[model samples]
Target: MDVCVCTPQEWDTIRSQRADALDASLESLGAQPVPPVFHTTAAPDPSPFGIQNDSDSERDPDDIPIFGEQLHAPSQSPTDTLRNITRSVRLNVNGVPRDRSTWKTLRDFVDERTIEDVLDTIESDRNALDDILARTSDYPESLSNTIAAIEGSVPAENTLPSMQDIFQAQGIASTDMASHLESLAAHFEQMSTALEHHEAGETFVHEDLHDWGTTWAEMNRDTEELPAILSEMEERLVSIDAAQWVPVLSQSRELSNVNRHSTKLVATKRTAQQNLDAHRRILDDLDELGEIMSEMLERQQAVEDEAREHVALLHHHIVTIEDLQHRFTSYQYAYSKLLLELARRRQYRDASDRIVNGMIAQLNAMTEGTFSSPQSQASTHEPEHGQYLPEDVCLFVQNAPTRWNVVPHNQELEVLPEIDSDLLDDARLRVGTGVAALGASQSL
Candidate 1:
């Protein structure tokens, strides 16, 4: 026996002939139907050597469930992954039948599984975005409600925060009216330089200090009968006996209670002013948050304007937010003016308190006087012209006698029924001269 050997040229010719034969065989397999045997098992029964040379792989159709129906669990290892797929050589695409000519078995199988995984990722992202959007949808309604609450608390036209109303409400209580009226009158007489400067400055119209002239006129009218009352009181003062001093002590105690109430009113006003100053920026902060929400909503709109299912609802929230901003602007202006008015009022309130406090002291001094002789109680020394606080000076319209106001009288005239009328010698003096004092008078 002998071995056959070929030169380089002979080997090249043989290789070309084999290549052509393989290409022809590949075309023949691609044209024919894939036998069902290859589709039946992962490890099929062995066939003759000429069975397949280029086709990659095939599996039993029943081994793969529907692709999306049986999702791959993340815990499963790659080797255990199911090769479920939707596309098949038996199906048609675009009016043409699917077969070996248009579909590669192994490649198509892997591609379908990969596509399903990618779709799952997209679904997860969409669900996460939906959760965030649900929360986002609520913001505009809450913002609108907050703005409504603020607007409700605000006075109509910001009136209550103004000085006119603050002073008026605090000063006009039934128990406190007279004291405040008199105090305000005294304050006007001796206004502080700061008070004067505030009056001159233009923030809001001073409006004659909330129409002081009207108040002054009303005070004058109400006091018209006071002169007569004071006259009667003065007559009683001159005529009262020592026994009547108890009433004066009682009145002094009452005035002390009035003093306490007055101070409380002033303190309450101060607290209100402090509150206004503290929360001045609330509206500004709310407005900023609203702008931020609107910007966020605008970003969402850019992405979903055409495709969003709740486009109408989104547009409604945007409109509501815009309305809130417009309404908030009015409050901003009113709040600013209100604060200024209240600030000015505080100075006057202090001035008024000082004046009223001084008058209370003067009333205390007069009420404490008792019916005692000059020598029995040490005589009070006269105050010098400038010694008393300006408010302590009595500016009564009828200035009569200052002594009568400050000093207590020793007695009042009293009629004695038992005294004789004959001794007086008027017209006819009958048994009147003989009549003598009776009852419990002389014996005691």
Candidate 2:
């Protein structure tokens, strides 16, 4: 059975028709009639209402046909009888209209057409919605396959050497990927929808979309008209008991603030933890480096001490050579003086030999004895082969002491005290003095 309900536009049309008929009846009876209006005129709703103009016909808004159009009274279409029209002319003028304030939000007020329209919209975008839904349909299979592939291709146990958390990597789950794809598809669909709506010449006003929430909340009811509906709503909002909700709202706000701060603090804690870990690792490396440097320093110190000892030995050798050179110079001077004295003594010995020879010749003439001087006999004097023979005197004469000192630059010069001849033994010197005295006496 086909059933339909009248819309507000159809109701208004019926009311206007009734008012006109009532006005006509009162004029014929010669009585003043109420103005032919039930409510103030307003712009008509644009939504279709399944009714057309019947120019010469009269209808009533409150009159309803139940079950079907078969019950409608087709015989009273015109009502040409003046008696019947006059009898019904006394209508209530101050009758209260239907309460339409709940028409938008009440569940019983919405018509079937609005539900059909919503269903139609859903049907219109079915393909796009299907495409979005299809993305996640394979989630279970895909996730299982991904896990299987990972298990097959990659070992679960870490194969690489341990990094000790020195590095990090990020991974996405199959479900996450599917969800991301779904979101992207939804975004594309929304963009396509918006573009299509824009191209269809629809205005971008909030009023066009705001009516859906009202239409959706409503169920079944005739829309009502009121002179001060908007004003009553304003008063309701202004007179709300705000004192009852202030603490709840404040607590919610405080909770939100605490949550925001807690999130920030958690992030700070994570960042600080990362910093501490990195610093600890760096500190470990630095400590190890410090230990290595300390060991190197100790080894270097040992080498330096050894080098200093070697330098000291070399310096001592250099000083001993210099002292030996000074003594050698003094011996050379003494040896030259000894050679001079030897030459002088040899000349004196020759003169003494001549005098002794003369005395011997005279004694031999007197006593007729054979006497010969020592020089007239064979000498057989072997050459001196001892330390007295200085090594290569010609080498000292030919070469000037070009590098007598072998001291290096920056090396300290060692000073030795002057040698005191009194420190020598007198016995070693007296033999040399006695030999010289005997030679002197023989010469005299």
Candidate 3:
């Protein structure tokens, strides 16, 4: 087969030297380091349930005795009275209380030495439920084998350049495609002179539509002062709902749903300003300049939808003046906590009426005329002998007589009642004039 005819640049330099020797044998087999597949297999016979035994005439398939020959009910020893009546008929079929002496005292208190401390507390609660099910099954299989070993270590197809490296990158992009089409035709003639100066600045009007028609005539004179500022905030919320110490605020159905959404946003901003002044008088009698630029873009989209409904009716009149200033600051904090609980219950009823008038002037200075009325002490003088005696027989006849008719101070004296000190200086001048009128009513 000696008829050779290579040519196309010697088949593009033998296909770029066999694609650079197959990219240097795939970069030396990707820097060669994969060696860990050690799957040794012989250790599985520690069979708890994996039954095997094959000798002694092939018998031990886990000693094959499961329900062997099936006729079962015979072994009954533990002091069997028919094994305590078949364990009280299996503790009444398991709902337990068949009380054969309380299950023979809990089967002699669990026999195998307390059932190895209840199988060591059920083998420490089954090794804490098998360590919470082996950390919920080994943390999602070790986060899905570390995201499948990071998407199987990434390299799927990238390095394939051969046909003489795409014919020398297509002869360096056809020698820079005619200086990139003459710098893309001088960037398309500077984007056609910036789109003919943006079509001569779109032929005119936009000073933001004459500052949005002088901000829509100053938002229609501020929406005609929003009905006198919502009628002076509904007359200061009707004088704070006729104030008697103000608490009412069930916001009158949120101020009548904010005055029916500000009268339906002032009738939808006067029907979007009469459809933007009838599309600016049909764009000033359109002489057909494309119907006056489509009626000035429908009057600038109806003045931006009536300035977004007058900024949502001035944010619903600033949230109804911040909910009537938080209900006038909760009605001046409930009328200053009801005037400080009525000046603390009028200074606790004037200190309990000056401590009940100094305890009625010390009980009228110790029972003043020793409780008189025996017809005013027999019209003032006679019952005096043992002045009605019994005050422990006048202190045992003034301290010594056992009872010689117990007559102590025979009786006409009555004097000693001075110390009222003007009822303790008028109860310390009415408690210093109620603490200086509660410190001048708390400095007003």
Candidate 4:
């Protein structure tokens, strides 16, 4: 194989083609473009032979702009960037939704942050500002001295690495970078001075030592007056001392003696009271007994009168019954004759017998006695025989009908001989004795 040495024109054309190919590859892979370098050979041609290429100079990978590759250049001013950063940071801090007022607060905060950023940029690149002045030959000796003094004031460990260190490591230097740093520093210094003036103006509103003296004077007046008021109170208190209270002390002693004797007298009175109470109770009991006796006498008299009326009414009932039975007998005789007449007439034979039988049954019930009928075995009696019947018969009569002959039975009833006045007195005496015995038993 024969090697062909390439001309300068061909070399330049090959380098441009290689660069275009690399740019296309970077675009396809979403990667940054590689730095410029020399190529040793061209790509393969359409002919049978193809060539492998190597590089003459190794690409400096660090020289690529990372900021340009990854981040888009937003169409925003510095003010807008500062505002956005403030809004985002405020949302992160408070975790609350923001409105227009919140945005205004954020705007103020953004201004503060922008000024701080300017200050930080100025502070970090202070040496760069001096370097710019030095290159231009514009920095005075005193300014240089002041910078050196400030730098010396910072401890060695606390000092930040300069941009020159980065440039030296990369074998590159920025000619305009220092001038940019100087412009930023001057603006930052102006902002700082304005902020200091604003703070100083606000500070003047605070109270001075003379105002403190006024408060101290008021406190002293309160202290002095309070003691004099206390002294006057002390004099008033002195008027109530033991010497001035001798009469009151004597009165208190007399009252105490009187109270003591009154307590003893009350105890003696209680003893006498117990004896008097016993006598009064005896009199009360006698009075109650007398009242009971009087009530009993009145009840006895009423019972006696009621008994006399009841006896007379009973006698009248007996006579009335006797008269009714006599009438019943007469009716029976007439009915018997009528029955015989009907038997002779051959009229109502069974019906007349039934009615006669019912009448006989009713008569037996009323008289509470027995008399046999030949045909039906039904019996009846006269009123004279009714008294000889059982006591249940009397009870039956008492309940069965309301009137013997148009009279209330309960009204006609007499008090029994057992509840007579003489008997009532005897019972009352026995009841009083029992009650007294019960009281005594309970006391025991």
Scored against the true structure, residue 160 in model 1 reaches a CA lDDT of 28
- What lDDT score goes with residue 149 in model 4? 56
**Candidate 2's C-alpha lDDT?**
0.36
Candidate 2 local lDDT, residue 51: 24
Which is better, 2 or 3, measured by TM-score? 2
Q: Is candidate 3 or candidate 4 better by TM-score?
A: 3
Q: Quote the RMSD, in angstroms, for model 2.
A: 71.4
Clashing pairs in 4: 371-379, 371-380
Candidate 1, superposed: residue stretches over 4 Å from native: 1-115, 131-255, 259-281, 290-444
List CA RMSD, all candidates. 73.4, 71.4, 52.2, 70.9
3 or 4, which is superior by lDDT?
3
Estimated TM-score per prediction? Answer: 0.22, 0.20, 0.19, 0.17
lDDT of model 3 at position 183: 49
Model 3 over residues 1-444: C-alpha lDDT tens digits?
122233323433543543343334234323321111100112221211222334677674323221112123323342333333333334343322423232221112112343234335434543443443343344446456655654554434333324465445445544554454464465456446546866887542446435433333544565565566445434444323233211342333344333222344456566667666765655544344456456656755665554444434333333332332233233223323433444466566567667767776666654454543344544444346656655554342332212112122653222111112332343344354445433432332
Locate the minimum summed-lDDT window of 10 residues in model 1.
Answer: 414-423
In angstroms, how far off is 12's CA in candidate 2? Answer: 99
For candidate 1, report its TM-score.
0.22
Clashes of each: 1, 9, 0, 2
